[model samples]
Target chain A: MDKVIKGKVWKFGDDIDTDLITPGKWLGSPELKDHVLETEDPDFPKQVQKGDVIVAGKNFGCGSSRETAPEALLQMGIVATFCESYARIYYRNSIGLGLPPLIVPGVSKEIEKGDEIEFSFETFKLKNLRTGKELQAERIPDFLLEILEGGGQEKILKKKLKQKLKELRAKKE
Target chain B: MVRPMTIAEKILARAAGKEEVKPGEYLIAKIDLLMAHIAAARIVARFMGFPAKVRKVFDPEKVVVLEDHFVPAPTVFAANAQKMIREWAFKQNLKYFYDIKAGICHQILPEKGHVRPGMLIVGTDSHTTTYGAYNAAGTGIGDTDGTVAAALGELWFKVPETIRFVLDGKLPKYVMSKDIILKIAGDYKADVACYKSIEFVGKAAEDMSIASRATLSNFSMELGAKFAFTPPDNKIIDFLKGRTEKPVTSDDLVKPDEKAEIEKIYELDVSDLEPQVACPHTVDNVKPVSELKDVEIQQAFIGSCTNGRLEDLKIAAEILKGHKVHKKTRLLIIPASQEIYKAAIKEGIIETLIDSEAIICNPNCGPCFGAHMGMLAPKENCISASNRNFKGRMGSEDAGIYLASPAVVAASAITGVITDPRTL
Candidate 1:
């Protein structure tokens, strides 16, 4: 598993709902990638490069549990989100989809918009390359890390079923 | 060690196949019931990609699929999604399929006697918590999470702390359960119950009707709660009496442990409270009904799982009887289920509402979703009985949405703007 992620920070405030991330109207759109985060920041989909990180204040992903919220970020080449807190469903969806939402302590206030951030999943630390300050985030939960290693819950189920079938075939033989 | 367990923790512990559980602990619990609206089910069925249909599931008897979101297929996508799920449910031999003739999933589940105390129910929509009114340990889930829970019959949860909301007094006339929840959401702030369960107790909760209880649990999401419940009171038992084959006594209900560590406690006196409304842009931006008394509104909507019930419809019908909706305003009434629709019709409540020039529609989440029908035009203002009042919630981002009770929404529809229901 990749433990280190370095990216340019994109800032947002509290309650960054799924509607703003990817509105309901654009749920099945092939052009969703272009409109991703368009409601929040018009330039986001255009300017966001391959390793951009979203750092938002408390209660991030606050409304409506749409998987498209994280899908929008992932498809736009945004890799990670650092929030003070997260709504339960959105948090579960993010880790289950392989896009990790790390709960960093006050990283939103400490880091400037567009600052270079180096995140270490193992150490639970974020280094501000521009400001030369280090901030600590909560250690990734063990269950979530395990899920990530298994390529998320979907893969885990596939592997579990496959193993079960193999065991049954071997026993029958 | 499990020191003490609330009704929620106990149900979770039992479902997790453990003797006990505590707050903040994560466990994979067995799901007793799995439900999804047609739109959400379609998304879940196709979540694995490649234009798939979820033709087989673990237990067909345990799964429920409801065609409530877009009943007759408003959009092409909705039509396709509903058709695919209907076909898939049939293939899976799903036990409960409330086709378009039925209404909202939350309302129909209880009305059909599927919900029971001590059960662990999971649904694709955010208002699944509404089942908590039956004393079931229920919580809303996202599409992907719901799909997994439905297929595998299990889902992971981080046990939440409890917030005890003690409703100490009798609710005065015109102050419905909707008002109490709004007061809690507005006064106490959204995070008060965030990641926690709010266990309702005291006289008010005990006296509230089943439909009214539904409203409280339905809006629990506004508090950011993981779960919210009032132990299945006598009202719920009585409602289920003949509808259910099994004997349901008060003893079947569960309660929170007296010794359990509650994160916080709040006492609300319903008798002293007035009508409340959540203003534009947020459910938590609540104010007294008088605050916006003069603000003109173009429409008043009484529907959604939050308010579309016989009890709520009666409240509107009573106010609109022998009177007309304001010429400047149009009143839209939606019964939550075909069951609610029939009940209102039998009682002549629907006729009275129609006589008042109120347009009635079948049970579905209409304007609440800003889809199909009832889209607000630019700069339009509406007073709605639905849950969320978030900006662009009903349509154009420029439109304003205000949340209130059915009685308040109806009274306001008569004169336009926000009017206190007490005056009428």
Candidate 2:
């Protein structure tokens, strides 16, 4: 299992809604690679690199729960999100897409932009590489953990089911 | 442990056929009503790329497509996007398409009778939960979930525990559902009640009309709730009368037991409430209008799924009747739909607003999106009846936004400042 990812962090203020993240206009487009590279803040897309973490204040996904929001994050290769809180659907959408949204109640105030950070999924902890400070977040369920570990829930389930069928057929033979 | 299930849990359990449901449990549900928006065009494009060898559109009639968010695109980019969506809708053979000329999707759905009480309504839009005001269980979904729901007419759900808000006493003058919801956000912050389905009850919600109840249910999304609802009552029954063709028959009822369990409950008395505004950069940065003294606005918008109802229009028309908007201010009014547009004309409300110099636009989400018609310039400030006020929400990133009730927006249009509608 992938235990930790290290990357520079981009910090944002409260109410970073889905519209600002992926935007509505991009929905109709065939490919999101370039658009995902162009983040909401006019200057962001170029600044964000693959595998960077997004650190934000409260109500991170406050508005519409557009899938584009998570898709953009994933397309940009965002590894994880550390926020004060998340909107209900956005939280679920991220997990469904195999991305992690860590709920660190006060991490928004603690972390800053360009700060290298270490994120751990197994222990549900984030370590600020710059400050040597660490924060813990709420742990996800085992089932969801299995999905995240095996890429995504659908992919994992399909793989396990196939393996189980193969095993039963072999036993019968 | 003997604990009672909340209204939210009861509804989720009934749909899922479980005795009890928790917050994070994932289970499949039999969706009663499924809705889609212009964003569903993405699903269509994907379907074109990789055709789904599955059932298509659970119920085409139950799905609705509203070309809101980016209506009358300010740039060629938005225009191109809208064009793509229109073409996709035609190919899909989905009937409930509301083009940019139609109106905001949320408002058009209930106005068109696709939503009613005691049913599960799912949409691609977050504010789809607003339908719960009529006592239906509705929530928003992502494009993938929407596609699955569209094709299968079924999706999974974890019965969420509910938070009951018992509001007592009559509201003071200048206070309305908008003020009450802002107060709830102020007290609870944005995510304090995250993932909890909210049920607003008591005299406040009870006495309110279906329109007023819609305003309350609409903003529950701002409080980070999965959905918001008020139980079925006479008001809903009365509202259904206008939509006889889409009326709920006896088989559509799911009456909660008198002894149904609730997870958490809170009581509030807002009899002496004041005009409220959600300040810039955050919807939960709520404050009474009087608290932010001497704040002036360059523009005022009175429409969106939130305050675009007939009652909302009439009240604004009443305030603006025979009173001209301020010379320094630009005011815009958008009816919720073509149906509302025609009704306003018949009732003389349209003439009243026009006489007051308010620029009336089509029923789409015009200036609310900061696109097309009324984009605000840098450093400009606006007071709107829309749901959100994040940076760049209405125009430039530097533009400031304040959210208020329709009355307050109309009054601000006249005074060109953050003034109380009652004072006007």
Candidate 3:
């Protein structure tokens, strides 16, 4: 995982729930990425570029336990998310999918929609490149950080499963 | 000496193999049950992506897979997904697998005796908190987390601080557990209990039936609660009798210590509570049914994991008996599970609903999350007993959804508008 991340911001308002991220109607569709956030902003999927970040108001991911929400954002090339706060399940899903959803108080007011921001996971600081304002984000716990550093839960689980299988094979000899 | 511990703390401590646990402490805990529904397809995909040739679930007996989300296969996409999940379940040789016949996952867990006190349960659906009604620690997780837990039978958690809600006084007529939870949401807002466990206690809570308690815990997710519990009483003990496959021991029951640390205590009197409704776009935008009298609805749905139990159907039937649904509005009644469906039929609740012109659907999630059966059109409004009312939840983004209790939904269906059940 990168210690430092820099990206352009796409701003959203409070209570931007999972439905707005990926609607229920498109649950099992293959082209789900094309409809990502289409309910909130139809142009988001078309206009969003790789390595961009999302900055939003309070309770950014507030509905459903769909990992599809964060998965869609990752597919759209969103590097990370900065919100005032997040619903617990969404925060977990985001971290599990290797998308860092950092809680930075007053992030919506400090950064503009198109502003270029640089964030450091090492220092837990976010700096607005345009205005030169810096904000500190809440530190993620060490256990979750370890998972994030290992490329999310999938990679970590795979490694553990491999070790288990190897041990089982040796035992059978 | 060991410090006092809340019910959530006690459950987590046991799962984590610790003598005691405090809020904000992170630890990996053994899971008693791991559940998945149609989204099991996603979990299976992720689990199969691993390079290990001998991949296997940690415990097949503890894993439950249900086909509830897109039951009966509404579309080709849904059909393929269900097929994938079915094949995977067979391949894994899981012990508890329910096909489309089984109702919603949340309702089936407790109804079938899969849930018990002091257990730590996790599912892929957000309403997994419904299991908390059994005095267990239940919370929802994403597909990847579910996959990991299925493989390892354990997951990490940050022990949540507990919020205590003490409800006293008797509930007035037409008001139910749904109203109490809606009132709490209106008063405290959605994120007030974010990442926290809520313990419901006091006279009113103790008097509620197991079904009513399920409503309280099931809807706790709407308030951002990590877990919600209505302490086990004799009522729960009776409900668990003969229903569980495993024996229930005295060690399974747990309670909060008298001196346990609670983040906050809210005492509410429910003597004068009214039917509450959560308006479109957000669950926290709540109002009494009386205040929404002028809002007309095109459909009134009474079903979901939130309030699709037999108790909810009886309430709806009582109001709909001998009355015809308004010509302008369509009424959709869905029992949460096949067990509830058969019971309702035996109790004549289904006949009463059908006589009132209500379309009784199968035991599945019917149009609750807009997956199938009864989707709303553009500019249409619906009064649903379901949990969520977020934008585009039922169908089109232009359609509106108002969430209320079964009585309120039934009354609204008869009037073709959001009507108070007491008024009817």
DockQ of all candidates, in order?
0.41, 0.34, 0.80
Cα lDDT of model 3 by residue, B132-189, tens digit = 8888889999999999999889999999999989999999988999999999999999
Q: What is the TM-score of chain A alone in each candidate?
A: 0.94, 0.83, 0.96
Clashing residue pair totals per candidate (backbone < 3 A): 0, 3, 0
lDDT of 2 by residue, A65-133 (tens): 777787788777688888988888887777766888888877987799889998787688888989998
Worst 10 residues of 1 chain A by lDDT: A156-165
**Regions of candidate 1 where Cα sits further than 4 Å from its true position:** B39-55
Can you write out model 3's per-residue Cα lDDT over A17-132, one digit (the tens) per residue?
A: 99999998887777778888887777788899999999999988888998889999998999999999999999999999899999999999999788999999989999999999
Report the CAPRI category for model 3.
high
- Per-model TM against the reference: 0.95, 0.88, 0.98
| Native-to-model Cα distance after best TM-score fit, residue A51 in candidate 3, in Å | 0.7
Candidate 1: clashing pairs of residues? none
Best by lDDT: 3
Which 10 consecutive positions of candidate 1 chain B have the poorest summed lDDT? B47-56
Off by over 4 Å in 2: A1-3, A19-44, A109-112, A129-134, A146-173, B1-4, B72-80, B98-101, B242-246, B249-261
